[model samples]
Target: MHAGLNEVTLPAQGWMPTLQSALREATRQQHHRLDHHPLLARLVRPGLQMADYGRALQALYAINAPSERCIADYIAAQGYAFDYAAHQRMPDLLADLAYLSLPVPPLAWAGPRLDSPGELVGCLYVLAGSTLGGRVIFRQLQSVLPVTASAGARFFAGHGEQTMGMWQNFWAFAATICSPAELPAARQSAAALFERILTLLESQSC
Candidate 1:
């Protein structure tokens, strides 16, 4: 879409438009519930703040950054494997996040074989959806970041239909639990958590 930047290409179909539609629909569906849900409100505030951290992450990884290369090299050296398609998804997702102007939290690169991908996925879903403003941000990141077709970047690209489905389920669960009565409290809590997440991300900067 924007000129140049051959390393990353925008989809011919304009993924951002689709992504925006999804976000708008999701937000419309959830706003009423979220406004009333005390916990949900508390969660959203911090989630918004987390967008800043997400941006920081993008800056760290934007092509030509030494730190970004360092991370890729480290992952390779560590022999961390990843699915190619999944890794490719990362740039688009990051791009979507950038488009939305959402805060980009720093990433926590746990090694390839964590005890449980399911558990980690669940946590990521909650943090991204409730704490960081849901799938829109994730999808955006996939769209923008120029992930290489290599083993090291596979972690970002590999989440297939299954992962998206699971994330949707998590959103449903969050919707069920959030209430307007608890929004005030939840907003405060979310702010605190957002700060914590940012602090954690900044620490990872090389």
Candidate 2:
């Protein structure tokens, strides 16, 4: 879950790649860990249980709910530099929590330090990336859990038919606003986010 790298910098030419590309490279190792994480590792198992899924959802809600609120507040105070709608996940996460009878985690905790618009855009990378990859997770959960978009699992289902559009819209905004200098911080934020999720889930499921 550690970043494992020192200061990050772009090439001498400073060519700005797509926002998705930068984020993927930044969190590449953490992203790869998805296959080995205790909770996500169960996805490949045929008999994945609701209890395991529930625990994972609970852990995610803990990290995402509060952080989403913080990001929203930051944007509201600073004025919108990116599209907030594409980054919305708290409602869906709460829906899943309610469906599973899990206690709703509060949005009281502080969030990542998004002091700059680019940093805020960086946070969007983490939030949006989860839902982007969540389509696969949604299918996996549907295969085992009795959850549906209505009953549960809306966090994974996300924007449903509009998911791709949401991604495109996010990228359009991010690519323009998230600059090359901010890449390092953005990458750090993304990696820290993954680490935080893994840590919280590990602690909870223990």
Candidate 3:
């Protein structure tokens, strides 16, 4: 399997055992408050199959790169600066721990490739949801921990009232992409992504 991607073998029933196991651990370790969030509870069921979620992710994958570029551009255009030292240090720390580096494929951020605001928000939610569990672990690490002084790190912070409205728009956009039947699938996709993120985080921590 390719590192940083889902090339690993899954079950015949399409249940991602590795993903499921990781999430179960993550839930126990970090997202203790997630059970209190109604949205999250509905999204992550214990017996949910991984293939169902993979389908939903496949549906959205085409739009993901452009959406991420949009968010990165938006952050840059807002006059915010990234902490290059922290960014550079993080990969180095991970490398020291023998973790494979994350892929950094070239991203295009200009022209008609730009995503709409709502799409951008939805994408952020997906990204956040996927990585938040792992971030909790990173936040606990003293050496590589994130601080508010870091520019890009602030993106991990939850939205406040003013900025939260934008997230509402994102939620609306996400809603349009799924139906009642597909909601389960979407949740599964989200869980799978989260699990993969946790694996990366764990590798980095080690």
Candidate 4:
């Protein structure tokens, strides 16, 4: 355990990997591959309708809602150094569901409770990466869904003008907190999360 970090205290001076580079190295390849997964391809397909939109949101909610809670629990219970405000995304997702008049889906599955700070950090990397991608989807969603940020686009609309700033804030936080030895678990966690999301989407896709 890292001497300063083992107890989950405030940020301390030490060697740490740049969160962005570390995650990019450990997760970007898989992240890129997952983006091209067939289920996701259908999301941005032309002529997508509200029914299709709702289905995608349901699948995503199944994966995101519980998984985020598990991640939050892991962080709160320990010295997991992170930006709590930046990590808060479930409300946006829930608001989107409400806007669409859809019931929040029961949890279909969550990969695992990330118990370790390292593992939780890994999950953060995966979740944070999604928000960046969400911005891209936001534009596509507007073209088809007839929803604005105040309507059904909360999840994809992201932090809006604060999107890049929030990403940078979270990325900077990650680099300082996760140690080199602990990063492998974080990487594996990220891969498992992506896989779980893919599986959930597959189950929901027609």
Candidate 5:
């Protein structure tokens, strides 16, 4: 919603940097910030505790639930050809919370608005990329915590063995649906979602 963003548009295809590359470059700093955020960092620390892991899940759930809904709703309303349900993280988050016997935290913020297809794609990029990253964290958590995909680490466990395949499928579909004209909106929305999550985590005890 910056001044005159609506007036600026690129071609439907043939952009120099692809949408994924552009999104990664635009949100690189934000991505690094989140990776080192204390609460998240605590998950992979040698001294990681079940309590710390539980708190982290609660914090993630606060932002994840609502943000996911926004994307799913947008996809449905727009009649987009995406199978967003297959990529949703909330179910796994909920399972982990249940195993830990932690209540779902109230939403930390309003979540992002995906009023356009470009915006929805941007949010999807962040969410899907996070899923890929979570696999690494899952392995790290396995060494420290007594949790597994079923017991308490379901969120980080992601799609298990099929994760890479699913991730590639998502990006391929994203490349097709996202036009050059939508890259700015996609980049801005992806960056903003990362910022939003960082803000939410910063405000929490984790």
Candidate 6:
């Protein structure tokens, strides 16, 4: 599960494309590692086991619960009009855990820093982009696991039909708010978040 262990490099400076595009290009390697993370990749496997799915859920909860709080608090304190609460995954994770009769684990020891707008946007980019992937995973899980949007798979089901729309909205907002000077931090934070999740998955048995 050493998915995101490598160092990150910032994209070269020049005439900028979209913020989301720049971040994606900067973090492509880390993103690929996270996509192939064993705990997550197994969800779509034909032999996917309930125990593995449960462990993945718990691991996700550990990272997402604290990360959501950190993002929410930052948005509120800074008066950022990002509508941060609307994108929360903690409740869905909790629901899925309860449906599976699994205990809610403690938060990760730490969360990614949201100290600046660039940093916060980077964190949001990683989190928001995941909802898009969740939709795909949710569909895959349907054939392998006894779960649904309202049951043990709510976390992956994400924003349901609005997942794509919400993702677009996030990037649009990010483009407007994330300035060029802040891009380095944004890129670093996004890459760091992927690494943090990989580290947590490896270290935590839940």
Best by lDDT: 5
Report, for every candidate in turn, its global Cα lDDT versus the true structure. Answer: 0.36, 0.71, 0.34, 0.73, 0.83, 0.80
Ranking of models by lDDT = 5, 6, 4, 2, 1, 3
- Please give, for residues 1-206, the per-residue lDDT of candidate 2 as tens digits: 21111212343213435556778887888778764788877854779888778777777776677678778887777655555755698788888888778887544245677787567667777788778888888887788878887678898898888888887666665655556787777777778877776666566656
* lDDT string, candidate 6, 1-206, tens digits: 11111211233222235676789998899889888888888888899989999999898888877888888998788766567778888888899999999999988766766888789888888888888888889998899888989989998999998898888667656655667889999999988888888888778743
TM-score of 2: 0.83
Q: Is candidate 5 or candidate 6 better by lDDT?
A: 5
Query: Lowest summed-lDDT stretch of 10 residues in model 3?
Result: 1-10
What TM-score does each of the candidates earn?
Answer: 0.31, 0.83, 0.34, 0.84, 0.90, 0.89
Candidate 6 TM-score over all chains jointly? 0.89
Error of 2 at 129 (Å): 0.6
Off by over 4 Å in 3: 1-30, 33-125, 128-153, 157-161
Candidate 5 colliding pairs, count? 0
| Candidate 1 vs 3: which has more lDDT | 1
Over the full model, what C-alpha lDDT does candidate 1 score relative to the true structure? 0.36
**Per-residue error at 81 for model 4, in Å?**
6.1
Which pairs clash in model 5?
A: none
What are the per-residue Cα lDDT tens digits for candidate 4 across 1-206? Answer: 23222343344223343544666787666777778877566667778788778877878888788778787776666644454656577888888889889999888875567766567778877888788888888888888778998789888888998988877666555555566777777778877787777777778775
- Residue 206 in candidate 3, Cα distance off native in Å: 1.9
Model 4, residue 95: distance off in Å is 1.4
Model 2: lDDT to the true structure: 0.71
On residues 116-160, what C-alpha lDDT tens digit does candidate 5 reach at each position?
A: 767877898889999999999999999998999787898999999
lDDT of 3 at 124: 42
Estimate the lDDT of model 4: 0.73
Clashing pairs in 6: none
For residue 133, give model 2's deviation from the true position in Å.
0.9
Q: What's the true lDDT of residue 189 in model 4? A: 83
- Which runs of model 6 end up more than 4 angstroms from their true locations? 1-17
